[model samples]
Target: MNMHSIPGRSDAEGYLFTRRAAWFAYAMTIALMLMDYIDRQVIVSLFPYMKKEWNLSDAQLGSLVSIVSLTVALGALPVALFADRVSRVRSIAAMAAVWSAATLSCMFTRSYGALLAARGMVGLGEAGYGSVGAALIASHFPNRLRGALLAGFFACASVGSVLGVLLGGVIAAKWGWQAAFGVVGIPGLVLAIAYLLVRDYKTVRLTPVLERATESSTNAARHIIKALTRPRTMLWVCIGGAAQLVVVSAVWAWMPSFLNRMHGVAPDQAAKQAALIVLCGALGSVVWGAVADRAGRRRPAGKLYAMALMSVASLGILAYAFGPGAALGGSTQFLIIAAGSFIMTCTVGPVSAIVIDVVHPAVRATGAAVLALFQNLFGLALGPVLAGALSDTFGLQAALTWTPAFALVAAGAFVLAARTYAADMGRAAEAPTETNHLPLGAARA
Candidate 1:
């Protein structure tokens, strides 16, 4: 059934559900997001054990983490482009199965290369989750409440990150690193089944008149390339949000290791601590999204300004985290780091909301895919590797010192991003009538 065909007020009927089915769909999407986070972070929590077991060098270990992100960057655009032509729900379910199985496969690997290969496969699966899921959620929710809903969905990352670290750490400590992989990896099969049970909401299609006039063929490659090359959009994709991912990746991937090496926390303890920080960060994301939505209602740049301020705060916190302060040695350090982590996470919901807001709905998936590609390639792929290499060459503390610099650069990007909000909103407002075609099939139907 075409869900959008239901008769009612557009805003009420489209979203802000009164029906149980609508909420169920929304919850299912969030669950998918949560599982996606678990798959990505399970390896992170097991890093300490893996390091000890494999006798891996810092650079080599960094490469292991980087491989997944590299694969993600490579896969994101293609999967995103493909999603436009196929069913997003089906694509996500397939990806979930692939990655979940890959995660379990990590248990069989005795060599670093084998493990890296497994992680890369996981990355391949995860590549579809972000772009496709974001697009799906945007389509499901009305534009008025999009920011709040996406924030709720994105907050699952924090939940998944924390749970992955906590659960993986405990499992690894009790059983083995392989057991950790098995536990986190096996759940995807169940989630995949659950995903199949959930209904797929039909997207609102773009007008056909515009589609025929604008393009001779619905070539996915052409669409992806065009979306990626949009000047203002590309600028934000590469420099703004993706740059922040770099610093975030470096910290989230290695912070547990850092605590163990420098502060002398055991593997499990460090993981738990990291999990706590992630939880706080998750809360911050939800709160920030709500506030930004409210503020954006009054001013167009509200979300951008919130992101900018958070970026600056995150920079200061990271600098403190790496500095030679007495505070780093105590339990208080966890609280401080948690606060910083929360602030960093606060940017996620708003950044996502703004990016989606700026682009036309038809190319939303493509825009998100390009953004994910930059975020993975530059931010996730390089961030941890660069930090780990620096730590190896210098010291852990010194490596962390570089985080603030990246954070500052991210903050600057947000400042630039702030300027484009009005223009983006304007473009989006005019897109339906002016562009004449739905970029995605949903708009045309």
Candidate 2:
């Protein structure tokens, strides 16, 4: 169906397809997203095992995670831009299959170089998945549910992440680490093929070029630039999203290790504990996303405010959970860490909705890709390496203690985004004119 054909404001009710079809598509998208994270994260739980087997350093271990983010950052834009032009679903499915196969390859690799290359391939496969999948979901659902739906969508990462770590740790410790890769990879491969059975939405690219020239418009270049450079688009969604991720990525990547080395927990035990903390993050995503959606109904700035508060508050909690000066017991620290994780993840949904609220529908995947690029480069790529480097210098504990502070920086960016949010959102609300083609600003994705 032409999902964007409805004449009213961009929202769930405006779905050109039936509610059931939209939801079915959403279910498939989210399930595949789950598989994506499972493949992306399963290696993390096997870190200690691989490190010992290869005599690798902590920094090398960190590279395994960082490499995925790096490749994703590099691949996001081009692939998503391509999907915007051709087909998002097929692109996502194909990418998912590639990553899953790469994940399976890890099970057979004998050397570190081969495994590293495999991880890079997995990252390449994952690069455009988030942006394109999110675009797919956004196209199916309405704008009002954007926050919660995207939150629920993003929360799948948390769930898959938890399973990857938990299942990898348990399976590896019992059966062998190689088995962990296959367990996670197989499901993703199956799901990728299953995704092809879902339907596609027909959305004509909305651009300002003349009707006669629209068929072969060079205006796509200009519109892409405008989409990427919009005020709120540049300042808030991409940058602010990256800022919050610094803490999120660092904590997720490092939390299991922290519990293992510092607290005298076994690898499997640490993975379980870490998984619980991440599970809290998943819960926080839905709760915070729902809160953002409700508050946004009253004031458009509510999502930004919600994000800012979550970042700042989570920072304070993380300090107590990780800092050396604290008098809290180990059990208390775990609980506090879980609380902090839950609050920190609240930003996931709002940042997504905000970008969609501002960018044009024609390039929504590109917008999502831009956000993913910054998020990976700034947050995922930098956060872990920075922590690992700090650990190499001072200690892992010191690095963990300091990493949560990035949330303060993120909170500041959210406040800045709020400043221009109203104006930007107002601009996005004006639907495209059917008679005369208007500028990109008038076309909300």
Candidate 3:
């Protein structure tokens, strides 16, 4: 049987593919996700080298990191919209190829301007992969497993970040910073080709409620707007998620530099130490995501509350770790920062699931893209640049200390989201889409 032609099984189980194919798709998507972050974050560990070679300012170095997220944010909606209307697998493969190629180009750029533009291209390539991949995973697997699986999927980001920081520093120490980009860029190209083999659900047709008899330009705009704004839950979640990521992105981007400057650690050793904290974050995303999933089983709104509590905890932990704790000792501060790292990523998985849960199935990717927009633009893009500017003014430690307070804003948004989550979910159920009631394909693996 042709794998692509196998009809999805339609039964209570509601799985779109056989267990093996679904898991295979899941694994491939996550692997690409790992490569995504590895390429995006490896630059962090190379900042020291870049600064020395180019005599770059902190703001300029931070811009190198922020530009990717900025492009990702700007392009996410359109790319996701295209994926929703076209083929997820093809779109993802194309995106991976673009980003991987962009990463490769970075090694050849001798000037700062060329490298910055290349980094922006990488962001454009990565723009919609996360939301599109999440949509693919949600379609392939049963709903019961969505939370844990998505958590694990996103956790790979932190894992990749750890490796990126670790490898970039070590590779740069031995070879050169430019070589670090070349080394990390290869695996993604191979993965992009392999991803063409992954299964994808057929595109969900837009319902009459969304696309009336006349699918005109006006209606299309209306459709897209409604898809993004129908459930207020998404708005709050987007804000909350972006707020939280401000903390994550800032620390991840600058921790190695912070350790090097504050503790007298060498650049390579600082990256190795910082990678440990990112590893803790990866573990935390999975653990807290499962916890949120279990809590939701009892009370659908419990997930939001759990996220809120975590945001608060992260606020307190991180603020102290970068603030007063710095005066204690390098060893003491590292321990506190690692603990904060674990708690701060609690919402990464649940936030995606939350956005997915409340949106119409047909526009799932687009809806999730909205969340990505806020996260990449306001949170990830803002964090590094803002911190860098502060570093340029006050100092790196002061910048890090102040950035964690954004988690407080995140906490409030989550609490507000809980107020309307149950109702928004009910509204989403009324949305007629292929994935909710019909299978897209069967497994041929």
Preferred candidate (TM-score higher): 1 or 3: 3
Q: What's the CA RMSD for each of the models?
A: 4.7, 5.0, 5.0
User: How does each model score on TM-score?
Assistant: 0.82, 0.82, 0.83
**Candidate 1 global lDDT:** 0.69
Of the candidates shown, which would achieve the greatest TM-score relative to the real structure? 3
Q: Which stretches of model 3 miss by more than 4 angstroms? A: 1-28, 84-87, 134-152, 194-221, 227-230, 293-303, 356-365, 422-445
What ranking emerges by TM-score with the best candidate at the front? 3, 1, 2
List lDDT for all candidates, in order.
0.69, 0.74, 0.82
Q: Candidate 3 clashing pairs? A: none
| Alpha-carbon shift of residue 378 in model 1 (angstroms) | 2.0
C-alpha RMSD in Å of predicted model 1 compared with the true structure: 4.7
Which tens-of-lDDT digit does each residue in 179-225 have in candidate 1? 88888888787887677765555433535554342343345446556
Ranking by lDDT: 3, 2, 1
Best-performing candidate as measured by lDDT:
3
